[model samples]
Target: MEFTAALREERLVAIVRGRDPEASFRTVMTLVEEGVPLVEVALSGADALDVIARARRELGTEAWLGAGAVLTAGDAQRARDAGANLLAAPALGPGVAESVRQGVPVLAGVSTAREVAAADRAGAAALTLLPGSVGGPAYLRALRAPFPDLPFVPVGRVDTERAGEYLRSGAMAVGVGAPLIGDAADGGDLGDLRKRAARFKAVCA
Candidate 1:
């Protein structure tokens, strides 16, 4: 499916930030098996590019693959070359412009209206409220009230139970990391991960 349509339909994105390439790949595969339409491999840890490449080759068009924690122009280009259909960053910066220039859709992280406006100026495809749990559903609702037309995705501290609240509060989607993908170092069970993915899908649905 098209990235935007998948985002709209699934209303959930599994963010992979694990350091182990094998574990990350397994997590993504399990998410795919469980019906997740979008997955993001964050660059905050090692082997992110490799994991993204693996997911791209393995899942092909089955899922919308993206790279997160993109903080520089070089990072943006590298992610694009590595087969990331989209890019996400913690804030609006020159890297976002680079991603746009490279024809990669991007979600810019923003916490306030002013930042949201800046992201709009930068031509972001959407906005992600970082550390979303801090603000909770009420915070997202308040932010969306002013920019109801722009898509808003909440990342950080968003669990399965809170996913529904965020969506109902007007989030275009909710990004869950460790809680959804589980810890790679711990070698979490794939069966359990599938079950969590299904639960998340049902809640977001």
Candidate 2:
């Protein structure tokens, strides 16, 4: 499947963001091995591009690997060159334009209709509501009302317990960070990541 198609189909994206690149890579491998469909590595961490590239090399073309927290065209291009199929940003920025130019699917973070419209105008594949736990599923429902046609992926603080609620409330998919990846960066149990990924996948289903 294509990037956007798999995103919408899976209805869940495992956000791999940790300070330790090796831990993050190991956690991502666990998720993939346990059947988690989509994964994105945030660029804020060290050796992020390396993580993306490694994921592509290890998981092969069937994997839906992407880059997150992208803000600039250069960042988007770097992600693209590293084999990122999708680009996600905290807000509408030059990265979205760059993704469009590079034919990469994008998920722009947004909180309001104005930002949603702006992201749409910039040609985003979907809109991810940052701080999703602040307003929870209710906020997604309200925001989704106006733009019924657009795909919405709610990120930030989303866990397994609430994944279904967000999807039930009309979000196209949900992006999970620490809750999904666990504390792998701090040498926490990597085995738990598989369980978490399975639970998340079940809920998103």
Candidate 3:
């Protein structure tokens, strides 16, 4: 399936953000094992490009691995070369449009109606509504009220176990960090990640 369809269908994108590639890989692998089809590796981490390459090589068949925290068009280009199927930014930048124009699916960040409209105009496939806890899911509902047709994915302060609340509120999907896959939070074990993914699936289902 195409990256966009995979992401829109699964509705659970695992984010790998940290300084340790080994640890991050372990965490991501757990999510993959549990059938979480999307993985986001923030580019600021140590050797993130290499990690993305490895992840695509290892998990591309089953998971849509990509880069997050992309800060520039150059970074986005590098991610594309490294095999990221998607690009996720903390903020919307014109370069994000440039990257998406290159055939990379992008989730641009937006906080207000103006920004969301701008992103839509820029051709962003979707928007990532950040700082999710400032107003929680209710804020998402309100944001969607104006752009009822727009798609917004929540990227922060998500209660993975309670993803139903966010989804019902307006989120296209919920990103789960440690709670979905990191062993440090739950013994850093793949089993925990699998179970959590299952639970998320059940809730969303």
Q: Point out where model 2 deviates above 4 Å.
A: none
> What does candidate 1's lDDT look like per residue over 28-141, in tens digits?
777877888688888876788888888899877545888999999999988888888889989988779998888778999999999999998888888889879789999988
Q: What is candidate 3's lDDT per residue for 1-205, written digit by digit as tens?
A: 8655665688877777767777676666666777776888888777788878877888754457878888788889899899887888878885586677787788888888898888888888778887666767888889989998877888775665457788888677877665555553223565656777788777655
Candidate 2 TM-score to native: 0.95
RMSD of each: 1.4, 1.2, 2.2
Off by over 4 Å in 1: 184-186
Question: Who wins the lDDT comparison?
Answer: 2
Task: Assess every candidate by TM-score.
Answer: 0.95, 0.95, 0.90
Q: Report lDDT (Cα) of residue 107, candidate 2.
A: 92
Measure candidate 1: CA RMSD: 1.4
- Model 3, residue 179: distance off in Å is 2.9
Query: Model 2 over residues 73-133: C-alpha lDDT tens digits?
Result: 9999999999888889888889889998888889999988899999999889889999798
